[model samples]
Target: MSEPLDPGPFFHGTKADLQIGDLLTAGFRSNYRPEVVMNHIYFTALRDGAGLAAEIAAGDGEPRVYVVEPTGSFEDDPNVTDKKFPGNPTRSYRSVHPIRIVGEVHDWTRLTPEALQQWRDRLATIAQERGEIIN
Candidate 1:
């Protein structure tokens, strides 16, 4: 039998208050444990006229989803955080092109794609198993 995958994420909070950037930050900080390098990194959002509205008009810090591939530090550490959403949201940053990183949010993200995928796959399996997703 194959070894079990890690339990991905529980999402302790609600999406009601969560925004796009919230998801990103939280995803990055998810792998935090004892005696780790903490990944020692930062992100710079891609700025273009397309996705600037939501970011600018955000009450304080609104979230805009985006399609982000491993940009930086992806090569440095195998743990460079990357998240994938099959059911892309309408409000997500356009094509993941014009991106923007919200100023200093919470240190709330994880660093394991395998675990993330495991959880995502499991959740979908459960939802499909229960017919939560309509065909």
Candidate 2:
């Protein structure tokens, strides 16, 4: 039998609050534990300028549903004096790009390639503005 899929810790939150630079705890290419779900992603509104208006205006990119890789630490946080266990990993000044949208929080209907493009365009813009995109 195939090993059970491990999606890691569940993120209990509403997708409504997601914004252009907000971090979304979601699976990468696949919904498997091996995927870096913890890495999270930055969200953008749907294309046609149709989505949360506040979120769209908040970003420096075009209005569209997109997500780009935010910075992530290459190593875990180092334990400091007095502090026993290291807290969450630190954020780096780097980013992984080609903003891929595998799925949504509630497993919303799958998006078409065209729809994905709208997202990509927005993400690309965001990455450029932040100067965090890495080919």
Candidate 3:
């Protein structure tokens, strides 16, 4: 008789297709971290996140593409004026800027050209929308 199918991985393929085998799947899956903000949106979109992350890594085993976290405060309101008091500071908020390798880019730049361009174009669009200079 043919050998039995190798029943494997505790949780299969990206919860489905990506789950090829247990050992491999394990590397690809993890429990959501409690410290995660954004309501763990990143965790919920694991497949897409992983794909993007893989693209970012560019096979160099380094995360090339990353959803970067902004520091301190952002330029959320570039219009914030000094017309406010001390407690009422007018700090701009930039949220976060998802970046792909520019100076130190990842190899995935080639794999997902469309995505990278989309990101660039999106920023351009936002800049245009905000009447910001796009040079």
Candidate 4:
């Protein structure tokens, strides 16, 4: 078999308060598309990327980044890899199986208010245009 694309100390981002050993699973509504339930749980190798995800996640709770370990096979997130960005520069991946929370990260960069507004504006535009989330 081919080697894994990344040897990640993988991270998942969200607003949910979770404990160490908590399991993040699939079947949640898409953060980008609330109408659809996600079949895969996504994570990234980049801490800041996860932070961005947490910042934009659909909730009012505090954003959080969790160090995670995938419980099964994962693949490059098709929503970004070779689609919006070429070749998984984001180092994002998704798995059908659950990912366990090992610990929390406290030092990821948080976006400024203006920057956060810009991102929200971008997401609103995408939603208005009905952006395709590659499930």
Candidate topping TM-score: 4
Query: Model 2, stretches more than 4 Å misplaced?
Result: 1-107, 133-135
lDDT of 3 by residue, 1-135 (tens): 554222111111112212111122112222222122321112111223333434432223433222222222223222222322332132222223221211222232243688756755664575457643211
Q: Which stretches in model 3 have alpha-carbon errors above 4 Å?
A: 1-42, 53-61, 64-111, 127-135
Model 1: lDDT to the true structure:
0.28
> Mind giving the per-residue lDDT tens digits that candidate 1 earns over 1-135?
543122211112111243344333222221122222232322223222113322322244433323232222211112222233343222222111222223323333432557546755665575456532110
- Model 1 lDDT, residue 32, Cα: 25
Taking all chains together, the TM-score of candidate 3 against the true structure is 0.21
Better of 2 and 3 by lDDT: 2
The count of backbone overlaps in candidate 4 is 0
The per-residue C-alpha lDDT of model 2 at residue 41 equals 30
Please estimate how well model 3 matches the true structure, expressed as its whole-model Cα lDDT.
0.28
**TM-scores for every candidate against the unseen true structure:** 0.23, 0.23, 0.21, 0.95
- What TM-score should be assigned to candidate 2? 0.23
Give the range where candidate 3 is weakest over 10 consecutive residues by summed lDDT: 6-15
Q: How good is model 1 by TM-score? A: 0.23
- Tell me how far the alpha carbon of residue 82 in candidate 3 is from the true structure, in angstroms, after superposition: 33
Q: Give the alpha carbon lDDT tens digit for every residue of 1-135 in model 4.
A: 989879999999999999999999999999888998999999999999999999999989999999999999999999879867779999999999999999999999999999988998998897788568888
